[model samples]
Target chain A: MSATIHRLDNRPQPSLEPMVQLVAQDMNLVNAVILDRMQSEIPLIPELAGHLIAGGGKRMRPMLTLASAKLLGYPGNRHHRLAAAVEFIHTATLLHDDVVDGSDLRRGKRTANLIWGNPASVLVGDFLFSRSFELMVEDGSLKVLKILSSASAIIAEGEVNQLTAARRLDIGEQRYLDIIGAKTAALFAAACRIAAVVAERPEAEEAALDAYGRNLGIAFQLVDDAIDYVSDADTMGKDAGDDFREGKMTLPVILAFARGSEEDRRFWQAAIHGHRTSDADFAQAVSLIRGARAVEDTLARARHYGQRAIDALGLFAGGKAKDAMIEAVEFAIGRAY
Target chain B: MSATIHRLDNRPQPSLEPMVQLVAQDMNLVNAVILDRMQSEIPLIPELAGHLIAGGGKRMRPMLTLASAKLLGYPGNRHHRLAAAVEFIHTATLLHDDVVDGSDLRRGKRTANLIWGNPASVLVGDFLFSRSFELMVEDGSLKVLKILSSASAIIAEGEVNQLTAARRLDIGEQRYLDIIGAKTAALFAAACRIAAVVAERPEAEEAALDAYGRNLGIAFQLVDDAIDYVSDADTMGKDAGDDFREGKMTLPVILAFARGSEEDRRFWQAAIHGHRTSDADFAQAVSLIRGARAVEDTLARARHYGQRAIDALGLFAGGKAKDAMIEAVEFAIGRAY
Candidate 1:
């Protein structure tokens, strides 16, 4: 649900390369549209926005848009603008997410809020958000606008929900899942769903793509949360135990807290409440999470969603596009290993 | 260019009451939609949003929508939701503006950012923005969506432009006009223009309403800036000299700086560069501004736009609605006295 970078460097495993290759041509057009539309007469708008937009994070959401268009076998260029719009929306949310979290780092780089100040970040985020709508409006599709706009509202609502839920262990798994669904998965679902709208495909096909993207998004986020505990900044491009320092109740904490012994539970309560923040506390926390096998189960749960994401494509005719899409889900799940 | 309450308690001059009375019944529906929609299961969103939404500022933008609909004699209820959408956009901008300015007070009340903090303000602003788009999509007019969305983008761009131009004396009246045109007048133009769209009026009428709004919006903002030097917090519900304290390059400051003596210029430069922020400095600023008649001339400039705003309605039939709209413009300019 947060703005942690999700690319994997784990070699000799399933990879997102297939989907990347499949959508390479379409993504180029989308990138052009993104660069062109993000420009403004106001230089700082582009300067602050480019810091994050041209930042090194993978264009996962837009890739879903392009890849879904391919999976439908609908030959049209309308999705290119829409794909750019998807990226703009994602970038806008990322900017705001950094401000909301008081985050210093994203994708191993200083956040826009840190570099440009929250005021510039907030306003540029607004500029990009509005520009995204301009792109959707230019496409002149009410259906596409509805899908993306609704996802945007849901994303904001989910962010607020997560904000209120922060540091509260009692929020439980269902509430946490709901938060991720809205914040992370809604845009993914919308990104894929709009391709069908642009391609003039049927609702069933749209729903199928939505399912594929939504489940994949969840799997991706679950892996991302799991990685925060195990990977140092050198490997994952994110500091280890960041979520723990922030007292984020990712599934690892949720499971460990639920399954921990009484003394361990006491430690977790202090940790989530932010009393435990030192190296020893984090090490102890990692040991507790390992003892409870929370990280393993979180990945196991991600696989459950990853399988659903793959199977959601079952109705689509098998082809290179479909194979790449399936392997993308596998790659998302495989990242945890 | 910043969020300040605009309602006038000054009793003897031209008034917005006629237009308020003209749109009173319709405003009930707009207000209803506003209350119903600002709500979310996330209590903080509604709680924080309601602080600003229910805050005592006049419903100036939505009132323009309703009155413009009356000016065109449009008989439909779609505008109620659309007007609410316009207000949502306005409110969203206000929320973000407060965050950007680090403002503690708005409409004489503590700002939502002050009450709930900046993160809540930023996210709730986002939610409201997305909700505005959803409302437009529900109305299903691509034209209205385009106008509003384009205006939205321009507003954000204008805000960024203003941010960059802040405290910089080089941004002359032309640049200042451009800034207010985007940050202040663009939505006002959109609010009125959309009424014409819903009325199914011709392009000429839409353009006329847009001009009426754009000019009146500029006039309103100019007077608002003027009043920053004249008004006291107790009477105007805004802190006097806020613009002075923030080193805001408002119209009065621009005019005074342009016309001041060499010594006055240094004081003005020092003031704008954050070297002077005490109440005595503000008193000196007001004195120098009065010395150059900058506030008077700023009001005169507002009258120029206000006259154009009233004259823009020349083609419409003479009636209470048109009279009310013209009186609203006069009310805006008259508030400066």
Candidate 2:
């Protein structure tokens, strides 16, 4: 492998800027489509949607679509629209998640719900979702529609599963993986696999890209869960220990609950299940989590997934597009530090 | 035409039982598909969805699909699945609408939100919507996908438009129609048109069914608005004066505001716009609506649309299916009484 090719052992994490720049031209088109589709005569629809869409994120999902298409040597513009649809699905989930989570801040800014209220947030989220389907239909590919639509259903089911499992101390590691896999990885898998379908690539290549994106997504969310326990508000883009406060059963918490002593487990039950918590409780919980080595173990799991993600790209040849994708996987896991 | 055939001039409104009887077997298939699709490993999904689906509002939109197909002499089984999909979309919208409207009761039963809470309601609504799209994909026609997806977007836009227009007395009759056309009529139109599409009928036939459904939906909504003004809590299946309490500018209030005296308009401004109201205020508002002939005028308008709906069915031959459809339109308008 060349110096630029990202490997599993690489300690220095690559910056997301290069991966973003790799598909900067396609990203611009995706942005345009997002803006165009989000417009509505109902001003609230555009106002609420634009607030989040225009708020800066890495646009990582769409970038995956664009990069996967580029790696396959597909020279078509339809992926631009599909990428936009992918982003819409992501944004719609975020909007609804904020409501479901009762979250006030996202990306260090007041959430749309805090500004526009939950009803508007929910309705606008529905509008954006519907708009995503419109874009997909305009693309006129049943295969593409099936993939994205099924991904949407899986995401909702994941969210529902998470809701049902909330605050349950017995939520196992495998169930946690299933939740994030459906909630996060399914969209990523669809976004990447769609590029292959649109390029008229074979099913084998599509399956490979799907595997890559799915593993990368699990790694990304694993790191995010880890960061919630360790990072400051500024680094994590929201309040630290939010998962604990909200009583979420993320992987780290699951590990901590599994490994902790009876007394420590009692503390978790009172804090999370009872929801009678304080800053000191949070501090103690964090101490217990780190003491139990849960955070370290979570990151280790993320690294494993990240490695698997890079391995999933074995079918693609060594090139700039492939390197950036592999490097993007590194960056996803690297978010832990 | 036989006496059984419903004509526009007919004064006696036909019952919906015959229409239900006509599509009885097909509706059973649709219901089975609904129950099948609603199943999930997560127990909460089926529990909540089943509660509402079995709560029993007439499956009017899906019936339009089945009836339209039958009228065209199309004996395919695809319409049953499509009909189920249509009902899912409608049920999904109701689930979301209950959340958006903060409704406590629907169809004489506690709403899903009241039983499960807003988060569950919103997420399950999303699941149903995604399932609807999946059904469309299984139908394997890009044209059907395009029509249904576009209608989904329009329905959402109409809802947002209604949200924006809520409590704004200045919203005119045309804007009101536009809102309902999108929120209500668009789905009906798509449902009816898809029947023709699945049957491989010509474009003209599709357009005719679309028109029939669009007009019928408008008339149905108009009667609903009128019912909101005149009915008791038991009759309306919700609290009487709910629209007034929510400050909704439905047709009766709109017409009343247009024709009422200056002092009467001021009462509306305080009660609806200013949100300063009481039982006495609602009672007075109802008296004023009756005196202004708004209820009468609204029912007249519904009748006009009902006539147009029957007219749109003129392209169909005289038959039980066509007669049932025409009667369905009359039943829609007759609800105002």
Candidate 3:
């Protein structure tokens, strides 16, 4: 059977508002640091960076860092900077991804590449990436630096692997999973693990939090990929079918392509390889994906990962932080619902 | 008054061979480490990275790191990785720069962007950048991370500033210096300073080496800028008058525009702003720049910086590293002669 759907009249299921509320104070500090670090004498650096940084998102990754630090009863302000660094890394990747994907919109607004052009976007993204490292250095923890830096390397590898695999319909589910793991989950894992490192928590605690974030990240991306087929620009904060147009090999596409008939396979190949996608083509692709139960399968996979994310937190004592973390996973999977 | 101009019959002056010889063994280890760290499961990463890594520019930046470490009498292998990290940062910037500049050629060959396309180049550049940080993390020194990371950020700022200043004829000498200082010298300064830190030397020694590298870097870039106007693609390893065609505000152009006749100023404005340039126009521009003695004046400024670089070495004890470093400075200026 398909996983339990948690839609409340097809609206965004119980939002990430609670988790965000729990970390609001720490997030304010993180936001302040982000703004301060983004400042530059070059107006374009700040102007282009501010365009993306100020755009609205859940700030989920940084929140995970702050909440994880709080869960372990940390007694310092170091996590604030680490959280900010996490946010900067995320923002930097988003900026560069827009350029890589040739995207025109992000967070329901014009992409930075669209506004400032690719050169500025690329350079500003570099600035943000470097600034993130500076934040990690200011915290003066080599362990934190190791985790974050390795994650950054893995993220780039994942992005490259994805680029290499794009439009290649032969890629299996495992490779797709690997792509998302490196591209999305690695950062999340590092962000949470760093929280434990800064708090001087034991190895087991660090591993647990890392596992939580990693699974959560995978689930988040699975749902995200699923939503790309089902949601619109308003709900997803970007044009729906962007992945299809870009020929990204997400879960639903992989599943649909695998399960398709000969004629259906030809359609995917024509649209993906030949770049012959149009409005009618996207509609037909979506119908084929739904007929293959690909969206349902993708959500099932997301729920499986989301359950693991919650289970990873079982060792932690139950509290607002723990409870909110679990709820955040639910919120993530609920997006697919 | 114009300082020594050791042209050696219009050839590149005394090469950086001595410095490379001094750090030969250490560079071997650095090369090994760079090759090791550049490896990834994704074959494209190593392929593209290896293409540039093996493309045979003198490993001058990494050599500086190794030489600095040796000069300070350090007795450790940590600098091997740090040097590799330095080179990765430099290479990553070059890869990204090629994309940003839409360059077709580098070091007498087609650029990676030309071969792999912009998307792969951008992502691979990111992979290399992240790999550099991973190397720094492996070095396990927060101070080294701080210095290198800050340099990276400043370099991005410098690059963005240069992009902004491109084609702006009114930009003065100080801003031009600021651009090169950030873009070039900052990394050189950091690469040298890290040696002192790793050696646990006093702050004075660190500051001295930093000053030395910074000045050398500025001089090297100034000479490079001047060479772009006077040298051919064969000598410079890239196209001549590239900066002029791209409207980059190098010192020779800045000096020429500042000192030009009214009609000459308008010519520069039309060529730079209006993009009204041709082969004949380039010949005319060269004559105008030479008539203004801007290339000579630019060489004069490079000599000034080279002198400061040599002066910064006075406090250090006499050794092969020091001698090679001085010779390297002479070689940098010699390029312009």
Candidate 4:
């Protein structure tokens, strides 16, 4: 345990020169494993999946899975399998979510829905989801299955809650937290936690890893919400203020709306509940948010969660994997520009 | 073994006077359990779920689950949990399917889509899917989870295959069978097979029961397809030739189109492929199908599967439950009118 702690704490930051070289070297291996696992015995599946997997989105979830497993001193190569499963689940959900939301833009390109139609996108999403389970089953660990299945269920439930909560201006922070935790963090936590489980770590170590993942997930989502208002469409690879356009009740907007005057409430009601918003409304809302310092407040909360994520990693011994995870948390908060 | 054989063969048909009486007596109890299980700790979920469950579905999947368990000589009540889980899965799929298909009608009523909108319907469907998994996990059998999860994955895949097969007139019978089996029959087979697993039946008996279920599911889906062409919208609770309208490539149409003359193929291409169909086109297509004996051919296939389903029961002993299963298969094919 002493040696483990020393290794983890003394680990050099991967984003720094020496560790950066190490990650660069391993990146190709990880990418190859991801590509291999994404291939399906069913030709149609692999074709559809390849369309998305090769579509150039960041492999954030899989990176976390691989890093966490390595950090936990995994001797086996099965982390790559779990990592691919994580990405597949994420990709599948994105496909379905885009269709459900009727969004045409993703990653600064036309979504699958825009290219192939919603039905094709949806069915392909289902294909990926099923294929993911097949991959997980190949691992042949009941615990892994249980964790992944439970996380999948939670993720679905959260999405449902968010859908129900949409356009309801009264949505509180607690409900918002619950929704994002389920929709975003549940999978992120499960990705890392399951990696630890696969590595056969002690229960406490697993718990620490799970906490680290959960807080990181929270921070990531919070940062995402904060960036929604400010990031350019080209940079975010999605429409700026898209959440506002969709009447999605996010943290800053919800908080700002709660603190608004009667006139402000009427403005928001007309813009959101009325399902009509112009650039003027968007500008006004942005000004209102800035005036209220909601962005700063939200960013503060994100930083708090991000720090908590880093702190949780301290429960485990230090290593290159832990350092990478810590840097990933920081990157999630500030590097999305 | 002798008792098992007796139980299988001596099962009563629900159409029989005694069996009808028994079903009537137990319907309330089954309905109660289903309602109880459908309740979510989340308030909005139960209300949303109730909108569909109370909308008067026949509860066929749950009935199958309960019937299979009882037939297998299970004395305990865990089957109720599994039965409820089966119905939840079925209902969840329906909600999602309607959203995917943009369907406005189901079971002669306005669909959840019409009532709640697509986003709500989609999310609620997800909620039900997750809730079903939660219920299955509570039964504390990894085997049950494996069966249900696999069924879910297969069903989703089948849907994707069906979507791809849609409007592709070149799709063969084998492809059609695979699509339908995945989309509809897979869950049906799983429902009964899981029941057998729960009962901890002998390996040979379990395999026999699974075969019976698979064949029964095929027959059931075949009858459903047949009903789509022949039954009135009022009776079928869907539009007449709605599959054709939606450009779905069901069996009779596939068979008719495959064997039709060039002129007939042109008419199908115009109606199905080109998505242009007049009343004359509908009438001509129906007549061509009848002329080609495609419907009859499909019925023959259905009957063959139905008979196979009944014969599979020969492995089990004669009993009320077994008799009911055999009769159920007969009713599925015979009562297609």
Error of model 3, residue A27, in angstroms: 1.1
On DockQ, the stronger of 3 and 4 is: 3
Point to the candidate with the largest DockQ.
3
* TM-score against native, each model: 0.96, 0.97, 0.96, 0.89
Task: Report lDDT per candidate.
Answer: 0.90, 0.89, 0.89, 0.75
Model 3 docking category? high
* Tens digit of per-residue lDDT, candidate 1, span B1-337: 6532223223367888999999999999999999999989999988988898887779999999999999998989999999999999999999999999988888999888888889999999999999999999999999999999999999999999998998899889999999999999999999999999999999999999999999999999999999999999987787999889988899899999999999999998899999999989999999999999999999989988988887788778879998888778878888867
Q: Which residue ranges in model 4 land beyond 4 Å of their true spot? A: A1-44, A274-276, B1-37, B277-281
**Residue B8: error of model 1 in Å?**
17
True contacts kept of each: 0.88, 0.63, 0.81, 0.41
- Candidate 4 per-residue lDDT, tens place, A81-194, comes to 777778878988898788778898888888887877776676667656655666766676768777776787788778878888888988999999999999999988888898
lDDT (Cα, tens digit) per residue for candidate 2, span A1-337: 4543446648575677767888999999999999999999888998999899998877889999999999999998999999999999999999999998999999988999999888888888888898999899999999999999999999999999999888888889999999999999999999999999999999999999999999999999999999988987898789988888889999888989899999988888987775656878888888999999999999999989999889888888878898888888878877777
Could you give the TM-score of chain B for each candidate, in order? 0.96, 0.96, 0.95, 0.91
Model 2: residues >4 Å from true position, as ranges?
A1-6, B1-9, B274-277
Ordering by DockQ: 3, 1, 2, 4
How close to the true structure is residue A160 of candidate 3, measured as C-alpha lDDT?
96
Distance (Å) between predicted and true CA of B293, model 1? 1.4
Q: What is the Cα-based lDDT of residue A158 in candidate 2?
A: 95
Highest lDDT scorer? 1
In model 2, the clashing pairs are: none
In model 1, where do residues sit more than 4 Å from their true spots?
A1-12, B1-12
Between candidates 1 and 4, name the one with more favorable lDDT: 1
Instruction: Give me candidate 1's TM-score against the actual structure.
Output: 0.96
